[model samples]
Target: MKKLYSILTTALFCMLFWIIFVLQDINLLKLDSQEVITGIIVSLIVAYFTHRSFIKEDPFWMLNFKRLGSLIAFIPIYAYELYKANWDVAKRALSPKLNINPGIVKIETEVESEYGLAMLANCITLTPGTITMDIVEEEGKNYMYIHWIDVAATEIKEASNTIKGAFEPWVRRIFK
Candidate 1:
């Protein structure tokens, strides 16, 4: 049952990828027979190799509507953050004075799952002015060491609040 679920999930994801990347067209009625055949063949091969990693635990968990909704919601929020960060970086770069106070700071995370922590770290790194250096687990807490272009806060809680912004909560919902 788990294997079947994994195969189905992988095939679905591959089909979505094919539509977005290979097809590059939204009109399904215009799709050629050859293209449909090719998509299925390629997706099946890819699914066979990648299914295990995606459905390591319960296969049905990922198919839940709540998690799917969270993922859909997260996309726009991430995009907005990415755009804002890029603009901020560009402004600082164009300015006469380099207003960067760079330093590595440790920020604690409440996310217990490895996937959740990884998502948080990646999100922080993607944001402008911050790069995640390392994630360390100490005394049952996860701490992310990040290099900040501007060190606004020295304390852990304040720094975490500043660096994480709205990402942590969404990630927690998605991965928890």
Candidate 2:
């Protein structure tokens, strides 16, 4: 039963990604019979290889409406953060007296699953003026090393709040 759920869940997720990334023609999502056939076959194959890590505990977790809503809600929040980061970076770059303190800072995360951790790292990387260098596990806690253009706070609590911003919470809601 669990194995079937894993395969099914993985395959469904792969199919969703395929439609969003591969089959879509920009704003309009058009799909032919050939594309549908191809998507299913490829999704099944990918799911077969990746099912073990695709889901951790509950296979139906992603199907929850609230979690799915969080995933959808993250887009605008991410965009807002991107917009702010870009402007901040631009301002710092154009300033005559450079207000830059570039360094790597460690921040702890509550996201337990590996996929959630990856998602958080990727979100941090996508935003301007910050890049995730590494994620480490110490004493049952997840910590991420992020290279920020400006080092706001060195302490773990402050740094996590500063660098991660809105990324971690939404990711936790969606994935964990």
Instruction: Compute each candidate's TM-score over C-alphas.
Output: 0.84, 0.84
- Give the worst 10-residue stretch by lDDT in candidate 1: 53-62
| Cα lDDT of model 2 by residue, 1-176, tens digit | 99888988999999988777863464424567786898899999999889987777888997799999999999999999999999999999999999999999999999998889999999999888999999999999999999999998999999999988898889989986
| RMSD in Å for all candidates | 2.4, 2.8
The runs of at least 3 residues in candidate 2 whose Cα sits more than 4 Å from the true structure, single-residue gaps closed, are: 20-39
**RMSD in angstroms, candidate 1?**
2.4
Give the distance in Å from residue 66's predicted Cα in candidate 1 to where it truly belongs.
2.0
Candidate 2 lDDT score relative to the true structure: 0.90
lDDT over C-alpha atoms for residue 140 of model 2: 97
The lDDT per prediction is 0.88, 0.90
**Deviation (Å) of 152 in candidate 1:** 1.4
lDDT, model 1, position 57 = 67
lDDT (10s digit) by residue, model 1, range 1-176 = 77988888788888888888855555777888998999988898898899887666666666789988998999999999999988988988999999888899999999887778889999999898899999999998999999998899999999999999889999999887
Clashes of 2: 0
